[model samples]
Target chain A: MTTLIAPVIPRSRLQRLRWTFADGGVIARGNLIHLVRNPSAILNLLLYPAVMVLLFGYVFGSAMNVAGGGDYREFLMPGMFAQTMTLGVMTTMIIVTNDAARGVTDRFRSMPISRSGVVLGRACADMVNSVLELAVLLGCGLAVGWSWHRGAGNALTALGLLLLLRFALIWVGIYLGLMLTPESASAAWMPLMPLTMLANTFVSPELMPGWMGAISEWNPLSATVAACRELFGNPGWGGDSWAAAHALPLAVAWPVALTLVFLPLSARRYRRLDR
Target chain B: MERMNSLAVVAEGVRKHYGGAPALDGFDLAVPEGTVCGLLGPNGAGKTTAVRVLTTLLRADAGRAVVAGFDVAARPAEVRYRIGLAGQNAAVDEILTGRENLEMWGRLYHLDAATARRRAGELLDRFGLAADAEKRVKHYSGGMRRRLDLAAAFVLAPSVLFLDEPTTGLDPRNRDEVWQAVRELAASGSTVLMTTQYLFEADQLAHQIAVIDAGRVIADGSPDELKSMVGGDQIDLVVRDAAGLAEAARVLAAAAGRDPVADPGARRLTAPVHDRIGALTEVVRELGERGIAVEDVALRRPTLDEVFLSLTGERTARAEEGGHGEEDRAA
Candidate 1:
């Protein structure tokens, strides 16, 4: 008689660690697979940044030059990296809003999973897409003779700063997405796009008049852009830049601040959603 | 993870009001462990409201509820950990694959990685969704999506499962598949609380049934017991003429102990009698004695629908589509 036997269980530290990380990995893998499967989103991420690069690189590239001492592409490249990463904020908002609108969030609420795992998993997964977007835009800048004179370590630091900003902004976008109904998420937050764009991402604050420049100079996006520039060894405008002062600290603080502000609000909203 | 032979779900004086209209007005239920309790109600009857409160999704304005030994209000997180809910709408994410949805829920339940994958595969196979596990949910058929949604809830082997109108728009075949799954869930020792507008579904699935109407329970009992409450038999006669209708009503009134009801224009007459066989024997003889030809004959115990009508003066499941439906618009 043939005896039935269970498969021998594998035993190893790596295997045990693999088993331990399996839940988070499955969740993360699920989110990544979703992004890969969505063709329209891929097209948007790939083509939109390329189009923006061609358009803005030509439109504003010749008209304005960096005040400090390098080519416009050099100065613009670091800021563009910061801008591209932040555009990922829109993707975060839309995903959250779409999920909430379609009752998917409600489903997660009823499930037995880690309470914050849903949102945290999405945020963590989206960071990869943001980095990819930044990397591509940076490559495009390189093709246009935009070079980072700063060493390899500084380049890594610049990317780190960009991720930090994206992380923080993702929470803000999530908060807005959770707060607004799906139908109105786009219309209600349309204003944030133009407002964030108006900052010192593309142009120098010194080029604009007093009041406009003041607001642009103080903008958090500007701080991120300026930090990237400093890391990249790009020339800086002479004014005592607030971005320079806030840069290093914000890499850590922004994400924490965003979490502190929005996490509780999202939690509260989640708690009362059934009511 | 196993529950003893105690109440799986219990609620006392549960009250919830939405925009000044009471959704669950002092509703109460006691569902034993490992049993399926069908919360039968019309569209505005507060079945969904009660499920929400018990699942810890909605907090009641007043009263108390416990699911799997955890208080829903004071210990919502613990309650959440013990119960699984499949809501009215299919809540699977369109952008994610069926496999992903289940895996995500598994992670939320804090299952380890290999176990989460194993659980996901098992549920996929159980729900007949293994073939479509990798496909985005947006492409799934309505029935398939519902199956996937239901599968996600089973990832944790939850002690108490709440299913709110789990098979609302499915065809007969698909509805039966869902019913079979629900039975399996209960058989696994999970306490199942389900709400449905389908009286036949309630009759087939519920170990104990509660008929909720106008935000309150009008009747509660086993299917057999509830049917017994309304009497053993009913004879409904539809005549060809209005005069015949009245004659039939008169015949039944005299034959039975109470006065029968007549819809003269519709030529319909209904009479409740003591015993199905005895009443039919007496009614036919009485009709022959009155020279009124019997157009039709029926002998059966009261259906859940009839029981609902007897207790609430209207069909219990019909309110979802009628004037009272506006009351559940927000719900």
Candidate 2:
């Protein structure tokens, strides 16, 4: 009532950009605080990697072959790392979808804040969450006797590649979240099941049927898993396929390509949403 | 003559479509500054769409809307700056505490951290949520969440506020709480446009009511003006059994002049009466003479529900239209 007039928005290009960052920072801080307040969500995140580690490292470790005869637990570590990244993407999608369905997105859209800031905030918040997930999975891997035989530099590169894949998946999640309802988005996320399985994350695709193996190799996820395996000095079949031939570059290329495709798409979908 | 700024919200021929079905078709309204306007309508009536368009959240396919002196589509950012919105759903973050939600909104509105914190505390106290400010919103009851949502909208005390079905799913006590907050907002000279299915809510809060049906404003006037248009008092009766519904309707039709509408679902009959006392007395005597079993009968003043029914029920502009909600117009 007292100050009914709208505050003057900074209109210059640089000021606008500053506002975008400021708004995104505020939203990101809110999301992080939300995470801190809910200890159970963090618990859920921990439980997922813990479950997968037990299933792969112990349950079927002896039966599975790790090509060059290395620790099965080490081989599964990167796979679990890749899988955790994909699950983190689902969490972002679910968060966006819930915000959309529950009207939080509309509330933000109606605000004077920068249009891109909403998504950028979610991405920032979720990237931090993904990092926490990777950390937990790494702890789980260590507990299961999985060690990165490669030097610290290579291990960090592997971690970077895993985060890059997650970053790409985050854009994909934002796009789908903006496009679909919470229920449909939950049911529609593919990477968690077929995509992860098809990728060399769990089983080296070379051992599967020819066509399935090809899909597994080409599954963008496979590149990251293979790249991680090589960097971590984990056992992996470096086959003659082009994807296997250039695992490191493919890990970089796939995420960049995926980001190029989905980043603009998510932004466009956001701008034209409810039109 | 009034200045342009005096008219807080204005819309001209707004239209929107979803697939083949037009959700909002040719809607128009003008609400003056500092007044409460209720966009009253039933389900699927495009009230939500109208609110979205005016709030700059959804674009209108045709026509222009001016909110607080800025064209909604052309100057959406400016409009957004001036308006507060509590969407149909309570959109608060479930994981954040009530206090955190307000502070977040404050910071987003460009308030400094210290100002944001102080303002958030003030709001929590004003909305009576100070006691539970530290509790996570996920654990808060439905009423608490809605109250927080409304408080978030007030972080800036915006000139224009849009509330789409603000109290739709709330219980009576919570509804009262929201209504009280809305009244305070309106009294503080903030223009408010709220949509609701509750006739009583519109009657209680809105100084001006726009009766919307089938995506169009069918009628617009003060509640009293609208009630007067329904002519006079109404006679309502509930039959003891469904079998007596037809007989009760026939007797009331002759006495009240207008044919009574029988809503068989509720075993109730209603007819507009010109001579209130005469019609009530005659109806009671006639039903008794005919041995009609009447469970209850009463004469009541015409409400906004009747006004709405009279406006929308008779036109049926869309043609496949039904009566106003559940009160079936089976004459």
Best by DockQ: 2
* Model 1, runs deviating above 4 Å: A1-23, A59-75, A101-112, A206-210, A234-256, A263-275, B1-5, B17-23, B43-45, B73-81, B93-122, B130-136, B213-215, B224-331
Candidate 2 on B1-331: residue-level lDDT in tens?
2226689999999999988999889999999999999998777889999999999878999988899899988888778888999998998988788998998998888887888898899889878899999988988877788888988998888889999888878877887888888897898888999998766578789999898888899889997776667676678899999998988998899998878978899899988887777888898999899898888787766554565557766633233232232221221
Complex DockQ, candidate 2: 0.63
DockQ (Cα-based) per candidate? Answer: 0.30, 0.63
Backbone clash count for every predicted candidate, in the order shown: 7, 0
Which pairs, if any, clash in model 2? none
- The residue pairs that clash in candidate 1, if any, are A22-B113, A23-B113, A112-B109, A113-B108, A113-B109, A114-B108, B43-B320
Q: Which ten residues in a row have the lowest lDDT in candidate 1 chain B?
A: B322-331
- Chain A: TM-score in each model: 0.85, 0.95
lDDT of 1 by residue, A1-98 (tens): 11211222226766544544553455567767776888987887678877877777787787877766667777777777877776677777787888
How accurate locally, in lDDT, is each candidate?
A: 0.74, 0.84
True-vs-predicted CA distance for residue B307, candidate 1, Å: 7.2
Q: What docking grade does candidate 1 earn?
A: acceptable
